[model samples]
Structure formats: C-alpha cells, structure tokens
Target: MSGLTVRHPHPSDHAALQGALTDWWGGMGGEAGAQQRRLLVPRLFLQHFAGTSLLVEEPEPAGTRGGAALRAFLIGFLSQTDPDTAYIHFVGVHPEAQRGGLGSALYQRFFDLVREHGRSRVRSITSPVNRNSIAYHTRMGFRIEAGDRTEDGVEVHTDYDGPGLDRVSFVREL
Candidate 1:
C-alpha cells in the first residue's frame, strides 16, 4: 500500500472504474457478471459524491505512458434522510490486488470520512450469492442485519431492490 495513492474520484474515473469492475468481476462470466456490471458505479455518484468516495491506485510503471493503475475503490455517501448514517453503495478491488489489505484500507478511509462528518454508523448490502463479500464484511466487523427472510441460512431482505432481488444487509458502527 505504500506506493498507492488515495483520492476523491472525478467524473473522469467512471469509465475506467467500470472497466475495472468488468475485468475484476469477469470471473462470474456470462449474464451474471454482465448484470452486476450494469449495477456497478454510475457516473452520478462520482459527479455528486466525490467528496465521500475514494479511488486507489499505484503509479503507472516508470516507462509507461498512462496514468496510475486502478487498485480499488469505494463509493459511499452520508445518508440524506438519516444524518447519522452513511451508506456504501459499491466497492471493488482489482483481482490481482486482493488479500493485500487494500479493501480494508478503503473501508477504513470511508469510515473516517463519515465519522468526521458526524455519522455514527455505516450500512451496505450485497447479494447473498456473493459469499465472499458476506464473509469479508463479517470479517470487517459488520453485523448482518436480520431481514424478513432467510436463504441458504443467511438472512436477506426480500425484494430489497425489487421483487425477487434480495440482498443481505450489513451495518457497522463507527
């Protein structure tokens, strides 16, 4: 993490982040990954909530002609309706950079940002099918919120996004 730089995302980052999501998430393959890609970071988040979002990258190789290489990102915002709460909409870590504490650093940075703004808690959601995400969040000290229903023994919010689009919810206190 020494060489990596953390900065607020700009509108220019949307396309590149989208590409990273596609590449990092490509393991799902076929329609599943495609569907997730559509729900990944949208332009409006970077445009409106850049202050609270973060982009992590390492400098391009010395001989390279491009910008830094994307390593990870977290898109989050303090809730307008619940001033004491912040919501993390999406997060991604380059596959090659996994297990190096990059994801934890992003979350820690976001927690500090929100806490500075008076937020006492943070919330996020993930598909129950993403067992890795669920496990990761749990390991990060997030408590899974009890939902209306359970699937595969995991609590989930039925129709959280819409009919049949269930999600597992997580909340962590700052």
Candidate 2:
C-alpha cells in the first residue's frame, strides 16, 4: 500500500472515474443500477469543469505508473441556500479498495477544503434503500435532515433514464 493523494480531477480522468463508479454500482446490482449511478458522474465532471465541484484521487503507488486509479471521490458544491454551506452530491470508494480508509480520507479532504473556503455545513443525499450509504454517512457524523424523502410519486427528472429512485438528504455541521 502506498500513500493516497487527494486532489481535483483533471478532465482526462473522467473515463477512469466513470469506470470505477460503474463497477461499484454494478457490484451493488446490475445494468439498471449502474446506469443510475452513471448519470451522476457526468454531472460531477460538469461541476468540476465549472469550478463548483471537487474530485479527489489516490494515485497508484510510486514506481508504478499509468493512469492512477481513482480510489474514492465526493462531488458537490458550495450551497446557494447558504453561502457557508457545502453540499455533497455523491461519495464512493471502489469495492476492492474498501477497509483501507479511502472513503474517510476522501471525506476529510473534502471537509478540509470546505472549511478552507469558510463553509460551516456539509450536506448530502442517498437513497433510503441504500443502507450501506446511510450507515457510512451516519458514521461520518451526518444527521438525517427532516423533510428528506425520495421523490417517489414525482415524475422522474427529465434527464433521468433509470427506474425512478428516491433519495434522502443528510447533513453535518462543520
């Protein structure tokens, strides 16, 4: 194991990031599930491209070089509702890389970035059915925000292509 480095993602890193996320989702289920996660990556890239998102990477150990695989990532932006708020859109670690603290490391990096920017809160959402995600968020100190729910009966967002999934919001004060 080598040291993990976290930083903003370059545009060229998109493909590998997408592949990792696709694998994570597929392991959780199949194409339908993977497709749902697939929608988030491009959005994350777009946010990063727009200067509103952060993408953290863990380069492969030194002396071994190619494209460094993205071990974990968090995507979101500083909030408009509260200029001091940082919202997390998504976070994940490659299944094979779990138990190495990649997820926590990614969060710490993001939290530090947010604090550096003077933000006071970090918010995020995950599907209620994703118990694992809920547990992880809770462990990281996020609290369930009231009024959070899946948009169950609402029409899918025009941009959405998968089975409609509901999500619940979580928040942590930094």
Candidate 3:
C-alpha cells in the first residue's frame, strides 16, 4: 500500500464505491451479482462514520486520465453495543486488486485509526455459506462463530437475512 493513501470516505465517494461493488461482484455470476448489488447501503456509514470507515486509492495507471482507481473500501464504526467494539459493516476489494493483501492493508489502516478509542474488539458478520469471507476473516485473525443469537432485541433467527441464510459472526480483539 506504499504510495497509496487510506483515509475517511468522502461523502461524494459513495456513488463510485457503489459502482465498484456492483462491478466487482457482478463479475461472479447472475445470482451473486444481484445479491451483491442488494448489499450496498453506503449512506449510513458515509454520513456518520467518515472517520471510522476507509477508502484507499492508487493512480489509475501510467496513462489513465482519472486520478486513481478506487481499489478497496471498508464501511464500519464503533459499535453501539455496551462494550463499544468496532463493527465492520462491509468491505470490497476490486477484482483486479484481489489476492494482493489489499484487504488486510485496509483493516490495518482502520485499526491504526481507532486504536486509541478504547475499544478491544472489532467485529463483523457474514453469511454462513460465504466460506471465502469466513476464511479471509479467519486469516485476518477473527474468530468465527456459528449459531443463531439475539441482537439488539431482534431475533437473529436462522437465516437472519433470508431463507437458508444463517450468519457467521466474527470477532477480533484489537
């Protein structure tokens, strides 16, 4: 990530990030594409958590006209739960940039940003079947938890998102 900068997401950057998400996941398959597009709700994070979320960009290429390619992003915040853990909401690594350790870099940058906030944990959740995410999170040091649990007074019933869509919660000590 040298020569690239990681910083708070600018409000106007939402549309572009949304586009990147659509493009990145749309490359997987029709079903995956539709599901991925449905996953973006960027305003909530950009509006209130610009400092806790992150975006990293690099020069497009030697001859490109644009400023740089938006390679990756993470939407997260300090949890409202009693312990005030940091909760990561969403993350995306552009298809072209996947497998290059960009995801880990994004997390490390966020950790550096919030390390002084007195939070001891960073948490996230993913669909139980998204083994890739589970593996990635595990590699990044998050403990994977399987099972249904209530959260914020809502029954995190099985398939909390929909039929056959149980979630796998993950927590990493900060």
Candidate 4:
C-alpha cells in the first residue's frame, strides 16, 4: 500500500480488472460469480467516466514494462436525475487489501470528489446475501433505506437487480 497511487482508470485496464475480479470477490469460482463478473465493470465506465472513477494501483519498478497490481477501485458519478446526489456504481478491493482501510479510503475519496462537484448525498447498493457488504456500508456511514420488502430481517429492494435478485440500498448524507 505504501507505493500505491490512485488515478483515473484507462480503457486498457478493463482486461486486468476483469481478470482479477473473481479473486477480489474471494474466489467466486462458480457460475454465480461468473455471471456477476460479466456485468461488473465494463469498458464503458473507463471510457466514459474515467474522470469520475478512481483506480488504486501499485506501480511496477521503474524498469518494468508493466505488471502493476490493482489494489482497489471505485466507479462513481454525480446523478443526472438528482442534481445533489451521487451514486457509487461499483467498487472492488483486492482480497489481501480488505480490512486495511483501502475500501474506506476509496469511498472517502469519492465523497470528497463528489462534494467538490456539488453533490450532497451518495448512494449505493449491495446484494441482501452479502452480510459483509451490508455491515461495511453501515460502518462507512451509509444508512439502509427502508424498502417495501425484507429479507432475512434486513430490508431490501426486491428484484432491484432483476427477478429474485434482492438488493440492500444505502444512502449517506454528506
């Protein structure tokens, strides 16, 4: 983490990010993980929202041709429908980097960046089954928005992603 730097993602990063996504998600090696990874971070985000996204990478030695390790990343953007709101579309932290504050740092940086752009609130969502995500978001000061349905005692937006894909929506007021 010492030499890691945050910068805007490039189109070329899509492959590396995709290659390591499953591992970052704790080796999601089954069909479910495969399906999720396919839709996770597309090249369009890097191409269109590079300015709004952040990529944390550990640069290779001066002489190396490539091989920078992707430590973490956050894809966020100011809301077009809601002038004062911003949305964190996606985020991923290398498994080894979890609990080391990398995720929080990414979120904090996004918050600061959005605030500078006149955003007063930030929103995000996670699957109901991801208890760690639910806990992490709350610990990061995001409050779960009450939904019309509840799953496993936690309120969730039913079919937020699609049929049977419930999501826990969160929002934080800055």
Candidate 5:
C-alpha cells in the first residue's frame, strides 16, 4: 500500500495501457471482446491526450518489485458542450487493483483537473451488463442520464458514443 500518483499520460505509456486493458477485458471474457475493447483506447487516447489523459501509478518496493505499476487510468477531454464539461471517454482500474480505492482516487483527481480547467460537469458511460462499473459509477456519485442504447454492428462504439455499446450514460456535476 503506497501512495497513488495521478498525472497526465505520456505517449510512451500507450502500449502498457493497452496491455492492461487487454488483460482487464480478457479476464471478463476472451480475446474477441478484448479486441473490441482495444478499439476504444486509441480513440479516447487521441481525443483526450490530443492533450489530456490521466494516469494513476503506485510505487512498489524498489527491489525486484516491478517499480511503479499503472493501477488505473481515465481517458477523456475537456468538452465545449458547456465549456464547463469534462466528458470522460474511458476509465479502468487494473483487475488486480480493483476495490483498493484507486478508481475513486483516479476520478477525484480527474474531477479536480476538470475543475482547474473550470469545468462543472463530468460525464461517462458504462456497459449495461457491467454491473461492477455501474456500481462504481453510482458510488462515485454519478446518476443515470440516458436509457440503454446500442450501436448497429457496423459502427465502432466507444464510451464517448453516449452509451452506444449496449450501455447507459451517467453524469455527475462537479
């Protein structure tokens, strides 16, 4: 149990983040669905870090402990929807690190970052069947904003697509 540091992501972290996502989603199902999940990362990374994505890291004991491991991440960007809105493109806590309060810490940092930019709202979406994600969001104080929605198979539906992947949208005012 070390302090968690939340900061903006660097381009070099992309591969590691992708690997984490693969592992995270694959644990939920298999490579096929994981492949679908991978598609979201690039888009969100580009959109958010076009100059803004947040990363969470926890230090491990120096010796063969693998140094710092990325524990959670939030990829999103400041939006013009209200100038005061931060649209969360995607958020994930490494499977091994779930329930450790890292997710909440990551989001709190995100909200603080948003507020620094003068944002007043934060928005996100989660799969309808992902009860864990829904529970996490609810616990973080998000409220359902839209009913469930699905994307026609041909489109690449991501979080920013407003609950498009058989999910529902949730929002919280900052």
Candidate 6:
C-alpha cells in the first residue's frame, strides 16, 4: 500500500501501537477487548523479537497520511517450541491504513523472513469471536486446524486459550 517500507519495531513504537488498537475490538468479544489484551502483551516482545517483528511505514506526504508514519506492524517470531514453525504474535494496521494492502505486505514480509530462517510453516491464534482475524488469516493462506467447530456462529477450538476462552488456531505451510 502506497509504497510502504518495512523495518523492525523500535521500543518507542509500542505505546503508539497499543493506542492505535484501543478501538480495534472487532471480532474479539467483550471479555477479550483491545484494552484487556494490551495488558497481556509484554514490552519484551518488541525488544526481544525486533529482528523478526516488523514495522511498516508510509513515506512522508505519501498516500493519505500527512507525513511519514507507521501504517502497520507485525509482532511475530520463529516458534521457540516448534523450531520449524514461526508464530505471528500480533499484527495491526491503523484503521485508516487498512484495506490498502499494508497488512498483506507485512504478512508477506514475515513469511519471507521466516522462510529464509528455514521455517516451513507459520501459526497463529485468535479468539473465536474475532471473525475479522479468522478471515484475514485465511486470506493469508492459513487454514483452520482440525477439531475446530462452529458453535452459535462462532468457529471455536475448545479451551484453546484457557478453560473458557476458546480460540481459533490457524496454520499455513510456508
């Protein structure tokens, strides 16, 4: 989108990024709102996975943005538990920048980096209620894992996150 450039996220970017997600409650239920999720995200993710995570920006005065700015970001990493797979921890695009391909670009960038590192697959999980995330992951070539079932219109993986917080897990071959 708009010739965006990509790079690792700096520590200072966390607050702004978190703030940007303040209203991004789509798909997530009230129990897992943006604000609630923010508390669970440690700052270390930005510091430790800087190389694998990425920040996407639009050049100054480009597109609808008035100046060079962060358009989207991806917080992902090679899985520590599974060496052959990478995990996309988080990904967000400013509402204004969405639908402009910025999110796709960030995903493509992650796929390339992980593939270079010998990763043969990628995985991610989202709340069952977050339909937007499920669709987006599917669009990125991730498929729902087995055992997931639709309940009351929500495709769920029972107890995926905890006893009650069912989640949708996605997997994609790299």
Name the 10 consecutive residues with the lowest summed lDDT in model 4: 20-29
- Model 3 residue 53 lDDT score: 90
Worst 10 residues of 3 by lDDT: 148-157
Which window of 10 residues has the lowest lDDT sum in candidate 6? 23-32
Q: What is the lDDT for 18 in model 1?
A: 76
Candidate 3 ranges with C-alpha deviation above 4 Å: 29-32, 35-39, 148-157, 162-164
What stretches of model 5 exceed 4 Å from their correct place?
43-51, 60-67, 148-164
**Which portions of model 6 show Cα errors greater than 4 Å?**
24-32, 59-68, 152-155
TM-score for candidate 5: 0.80
RMSD of each: 1.3, 4.8, 4.7, 1.7, 5.0, 3.3
* Candidate 6 global lDDT: 0.81
User: lDDT tens digits, residues 1-174, model 4?
Assistant: 577999999999998778666666765547678658757788998898888899999877788887788889898888889999999988888887889999899999999999999999999999888899899999999999999888788899988888987899999999
The candidate scoring highest on TM-score is 1
Clashing pairs in 6: 27-129, 27-130
TM-score of each: 0.95, 0.78, 0.83, 0.92, 0.80, 0.84
Candidate 3, residue 120: lDDT: 79
TM-score of 3: 0.83
The model with the greater TM-score, 1 or 6, is 1
Runs off by more than 4 Å, candidate 4:
61-66
Instruction: Give lDDT: candidate 6, residue 142.
Output: 95
Candidate 3 has which clashing residue pairs, if any? 159-165
Error of 5 at 66 (Å): 6.2
TM-score of candidate 1 relative to the true fold: 0.95
- Which whole-number lDDT from 0 to 100 does residue 148 have in model 2? 28
Instruction: Provide the global lDDT of candidate 1 against the true structure.
Output: 0.90
Per-residue CA lDDT of model 6 for 45-143, tens digit only, reads 888999999988777764565755767888998888888999998888878878888888889989999999999999999877677888899988999
Error of model 2, residue 139, in angstroms: 0.8
lDDT at residue 119 of model 3 (Cα atoms) = 78
